[model samples]
Target: MSPRVLIVGLNYSPEHTGIAPYTAGMAQALRESGWDVEVITGLPHYPQWRIHDGYPRTGDPHEVIDGVPVLRVPHPVPHDAGQLRRLGMEIVFGLRAATAPWGRPDAVVVVTPALFASAIVRVRAALTRTPVIAWVHDIYTAGLSETGAAGGPVTHMMRAVEGTFLRSCSGAVVIHDRFADYLRGHMGVAAERITTVRNWTHISEAPTVDTDALRRRFGWGPEDVVVLHTGNMGAKQDLTNVAAAAQVAERTGAPLRFVLVGGGHQRPQLEQLATTTPRFEVLPSVDNDTYAGLLRAADVLLVNERPGLTEMCVPSKLTSYFTADRPVLAAVEAAGPSAAELAAADAGIRVRPGDPEALVEGAMQLHDEWITTGGATHRGGRRYVREVLSRGAAVRSFVSAVAKLLPVTTEHRAPATVNS
Candidate 1:
């Protein structure tokens, strides 16, 4: 009989943006791989902090989606939540999840960003005699401190809590080398216990479409340079820099049109900012397939991070940008993981996070390169992603990491090929 694996995470699909889709995909992949995979996640409330339509705050704790069993727990939903509110929600969810009627599993995989919940899962795994893997998306304490939310006296406490939880886990997986180093150096985790499993492009493939017609549908013309920033328009994304860059470009008679596509607590602010600039536009989030189409249609793909987010995150947007086969203009820390990854992949251009002038300059340069090279420079992004961050490679690595936690029979070693 195959071993049963329980995945504990705050976000999972039906929620399109952030880490939700990735978690869902990972779960599905594991199921296809012959593991009896089960998930425990909260009601889907993410970039737009309200719970998704049809999923009530109070309802059945169990549901089946795409053939996998999901155990949903009710947690507080915070619309436009701040650090304290977010923290409270996490705690509530953790408390509920700890008491969930999860049957025995061979092992557990806890996804962080629900840092408190990971601790609960660790305790549960200890009691059940099950090995646990802390699959870390972002280094919570360091990231929260950098964001100024859990700074000052609480920062040390946060780190201590995170350290204790991670140490308690049988093994861990980090998305970046920097994160692994932080875990080892700051949290005192042994080097051998941590595995670096980078994220892949969540969107399956860039659908072939008529670029000109799609641009026209969005009111973009041949002369207009479409620069797009897709995904959650949340506080962590310093999207105001896109508006500022568009302002700077207009002053220089550049034909740049900045498009912010997605919704979040910051949506209204972004809309107000867009109102001041004719060249700036804001649109609601589209389905993943439509988003992939937009990526293929846009002239330039943009990524902006709030300043001081150096080690906080490795913006999942870059993986999609690389897969989009479009030129990228990133406004992020020069030494940050996103910057280094883009540079190493030879994916696209980068500038300091907060500088509007530099952003505009990078935009213009990429636009010029697009016109001159006919987007050959941008097309390199697709090849880079395929070679380095292929979805198959990521799934293989993930399964390998999980298998090491417990012995798997040779018959169960091979994972099904995931086309999505």
Candidate 2:
């Protein structure tokens, strides 16, 4: 009999971006490391807020993905949900998950984004005497304040709630050291209870594509220097700044063409903005292979964020950008996790956030540098990926961290049965 672990979160496999890949990767890695792993997650609805094609809107809730048993809880798939509406969806999912028939497991790992849902899962874990590990993807309270989503009394209340949920966990895993510090210093979680595991590129292979043909497919010309930004186009992403930079570039007659590839709540507004901005283009999300190819084909990769969004989340796209082996440019706070990560990797250049003129300058600088150096300047990014962000190392670290949280003794028993 093997130790069993259950992972509860709002996102999982088939949603290729954001937290889904990491959660899916962790589940698969745990199974390979000899743990019997199962996941309780919502249906695939991410970057694109609607459910993915081929999945029933309402039907059977159980499926096996990549050999791991998953219970998919149906939840609201809002097209452009406001904060309150989103919270309502989280509550509904949490209630459903808490009442679901998951067999008793030795331990549980809850991913926080669906923070309220995680708290509900924690309460259930308490009843079963199962230790819980919190996988912190973002600090919800900080996000509310940082992104200007909410503040004052609302943020204060959320801080109290988030702190309570994290402190109650047996241990917590954070993706960045900054997050660990935030947990210990602000949230009052003990330092010893937190582990830092950086995210790794989930794309297993470097994309192999004909650069010319790929550019041609997108209608990009030889003279055009495409600066691509992929992933969510949300308030935090502040892609409006990217659009502004494109307008600036067009005015200055720069060869740069800014392309945003992803869907989110802000996509419609960005599309409307794009109609009048010749140098800026918005494309729908692409499959993993196409995404990887786009990363490789572009002259530069971008990470853009709203100004003052310093402490809420680390841009997950940075891992993929490094793997893409292209010159990178970030429009983010100088002190934020994304800037720190890029500087540490020696991967890219960063400009002040919300400054369209500075962004255009940075893009042109990177383009010239890439042309002059023949793309040698950005090799450090690929080297960094191999040396520091290898998937095997990341998965092993997560497995080891999780092992410490499990009970030392267990009865030899058959697999636990699911409740009917």
Best by TM-score: 2
Off by over 4 Å in 2: 415-420
- Residues 12-39 of candidate 2: C-alpha lDDT, one tens digit per residue: 9899899999999988888777788888
Model 1, 234-310: lDDT tens per residue?
76788888898889888888888999888788889999998898789998877777788888888889999888787
How high is each candidate's TM-score? 0.94, 0.97
Q: What's the residue-level lDDT of 163 in candidate 1?
A: 93
- Please give the RMSD to the true structure for each candidate, in Å: 3.5, 1.4
Q: Give the RMSD in angstroms, all C-alphas superposed, for model 2.
A: 1.4
Give stretches of model 1 more than 4 Å off.
Answer: 208-210, 407-420
In terms of lDDT, which candidate is strongest?
Answer: 2
